[model samples]
Target chain A: MTGIPQEQNDLAYDVFAKACPSRGTLEHVTGRWGGLTLGALHQGSLRFNELRRRVDGVSEKMLSQTLHALERDGLVHREAQPTNPPRVDYELTPLGRRVTERLLALIQCVEGSMDDVLASRAAYDAGQRS
Target chain B: MTGIPQEQNDLAYDVFAKACPSRGTLEHVTGRWGGLTLGALHQGSLRFNELRRRVDGVSEKMLSQTLHALERDGLVHREAQPTNPPRVDYELTPLGRRVTERLLALIQCVEGSMDDVLASRAAYDAGQRS
Candidate 1:
């Protein structure tokens, strides 16, 4: 029997499918610090240190890892200037910008509804106590 | 320091700030199996077993945990049917639906661009080796 790669034939990747590559992309964009980093770059290119400051609490190692992953996924552009002490900058690729805009909107939605969420949780916990 | 809690004064919850509550919601919505589970429930209510099946590779423990977190966040409604063999069904709340819809769109975008991503990765790797 001739072998056929099922994934290519499956019009849309099934993130629900454990082996699907789409899950990796989903995780990359939504991964902790992933969305935030994208948002930071949306304004303009940011140097490594500036990005580090923008995304608080991210260790240098984690920030580097996140940037590497996004770059590999074609969502980020990394530029290292030629100098005695190299200066590196990070910016969003066109595809990344498209996705980042949506991610930011999603974040805005959550922020807008946070009051409702806090109220709901408070009520739920109080009811549980009763 | 004037006793104004900084978070309260910050007009919007900042996920990048690390201390903001929005990060919790973002993590919950985009956490492992979170997006998939919500997408599964979006179609209709699903039982515990059915959800586990729908989100491939999710263990019973993880499925239960994800559902509970979503319920706590007011994104999922869990109904435990009283019977000899108890039945539990999970569905998205209005709040949950709103977030799930965005998550699904993000997933779709990633899938649609997988070919581009694959090509980019291949090129990056080839350049690295050269």
Candidate 2:
């Protein structure tokens, strides 16, 4: 836990605060495309189309936007190579790797709980019909 | 790491897959309001309005929708008590708690990294202008 004093902590970026800049970064990290993008990059660096394939369904536009936001936030590093037809690769920065470690844990947790989640959804739906 | 066989794992729900149900649940858990809502409930059970306040900027409609998604997914338990004005409270289910444990780790990581994130933003912006 953070040992920072309560008053100092209050001044720190609190995601629960509506106006905090951290909220924006959190959204970028956990956003629909962002999480998937980062998760894909965690394996290794990837080119644009390769990332699109690994993420499965991100459009070129959304992936580009997601990458720009992440790169701006310093969670992702984009390297554009000058070669035949050009090659741009995306990889997680040190900070991004740390964030993704936690994120992948959360992702795997949810993946592991899918059975329970499905059952719960079924029960909830059945209750609604009765 | 999951020891499941690679062949069997391919059949399992994968967030990276375009059509996996786990992807939907992931979206719900990490959605704009979902993460904040679950994070708030991690403290203890809270009434609807209290959740709204704790999450800082959620509108009533969004909060209601977020809770329903979470409840249906079995990450949140919603209790409607019989009392004056009809009390309703929200709390995390066991599975929810598990998910939130990982989530709060990610959230705290983001919160703690705000200084670096801010500095990164400044450097990124300056580079853009140069």
Candidate 3:
């Protein structure tokens, strides 16, 4: 709490507590598909299929669920243009952008440190085998 | 990758790719219990019971499993002291510390924004009902 931004000090929610709403929102934001979805959208607004492609292995059902959760949480905006087929696009809201900024920072850190992690994993496995 | 640190641009592992090992490590770091466990340990080293207490609602089995995954990833160091009861303490490794720093930033962002998130959820649910 002390190290966090000063504005957060007086907030009513504590994610460490079980019943706090913040915990649920936090889970949605950091969940496997949610995080990737947000990261993919960070580049800009993308269509549904574009998102599925960018997120790699996410199934259609999983992607749709992830988007719905994010939109319900007010982190994503869904826009539908009534064209012949009804073109729909998903984009991060202002709040979503703010949250995704922090998420991307975390992603970058993890991606950068993978070499160290792989080496550590190898050593750990070798120890286990011995 | 464009906005990430310059050193990371050339890395072979990309979290966006489905098969990359970084994706698995990222999940372990950001998963519900894994994130909380690391956050609790970030405060300082703690015994198994102390960690369970600090993390709020984590079950014994989940905590044990989380700790094992983190240890395998080299993000956590588990020390078992030979004593009458054989005390075990969990703490973050240097790599874990780095990952947790970014995760805490994301957590703080979400915690501080809970009021907005709650208001958004209410509005969403009301719209659904109407």
Candidate 4:
């Protein structure tokens, strides 16, 4: 078929030209801690400590930042209980679930082919050395 | 059904516990400039200058760094010709193509649902204001 029709082209341009808010969404979702947080939350609703445990190396400050960004973006729902200990739980919204599912699929793809990627790196390094 | 069986659990733990090389690969492919570079290379082979143009807002140093990382990972092949100005072209290897295709799919998904993300952010901000 031919290229995208004129109206479709205009619509596509609008996304890039208008500095669409999705750019912010992307920055939030793909930020350093954001990816790991979403990945961890995909398993289930997690309390602060649980999320901190799962995302191995993330510092408390970074984790808090990431959660705030995701919360602001409406991808994550944070609920605080007025209990003795003041417990808080984080879970995915419907939109968050959709995004996390996609993120999980991408992670799985990466995990599945990680062996090939390693081998490729080794060979590339060998070639460079010679 | 119950949770993953013992063997599966052990296998899953192996991925994270070993400090796998995939960590570096992830860093390379997902770096600031790396994502955009891979997305552009998915289209076809591009000269250095051509790539520089497509990835908007990328500085020369960042682009160079990204290309080097991809090349080192064997996800990009750089062919430098013996010519007056030292003509060079960048293209994805078979491995690179596979990775780029996946990246492109992710980008399309992000682009496709951008409107919902924007609306979500707006609603979230309104809630914060009230």
What DockQ does each listed candidate score?
0.39, 0.56, 0.56, 0.30
DockQ of 1: 0.39
Question: What lDDT tens digits, residue by residue, belong to model 4 across residues B1-130?
Answer: 1254534533442223226555566556655568778878888999988998887777789889899889877789999989998999999888777766766555555565565566677888888899
lDDT of 1 at A77: 94
The TM-score that candidate 4 achieves is: 0.83
**For model 2, how does the per-residue alpha-carbon lDDT over A42-126 read when each residue is reduced to its tens digit?**
9999999999989898899999999999999999999989999999999999999999999999998898888788989999999
Error of 2 at A75 (Å): 0.4
Rank the models by lDDT, top first.
2, 3, 1, 4
Instruction: Sort candidate 2 into its docking category.
Output: medium
Candidate 2 lDDT: 0.91
lDDT of 1 by residue, B12-62 (tens): 566777888878888888887787899899999998888888999999898
Query: Which candidate number has the best lDDT?
Result: 2
Interface RMSD of each: 6.4, 3.9, 4.2, 7.3
Tens digits of per-residue lDDT for model 4, A1-130: 1254534533553212226555566666666568778888888999999988888777899889899889877789999989988999999988788777776655555555565666677788888899
After superposition, the stretches of candidate 3 with alpha carbons farther than 4 Å from their true spots are: A1-10, B1-10
* Candidate 2 TM-score for chain A: 0.91
User: Clashing residue pairs, candidate 1?
Assistant: none
lDDT of 2 by residue, B1-130 (tens): 3466645654587999989999999999998899999999999999998889899989999999999999999999999999988999899999999999999999988988877788899999999999
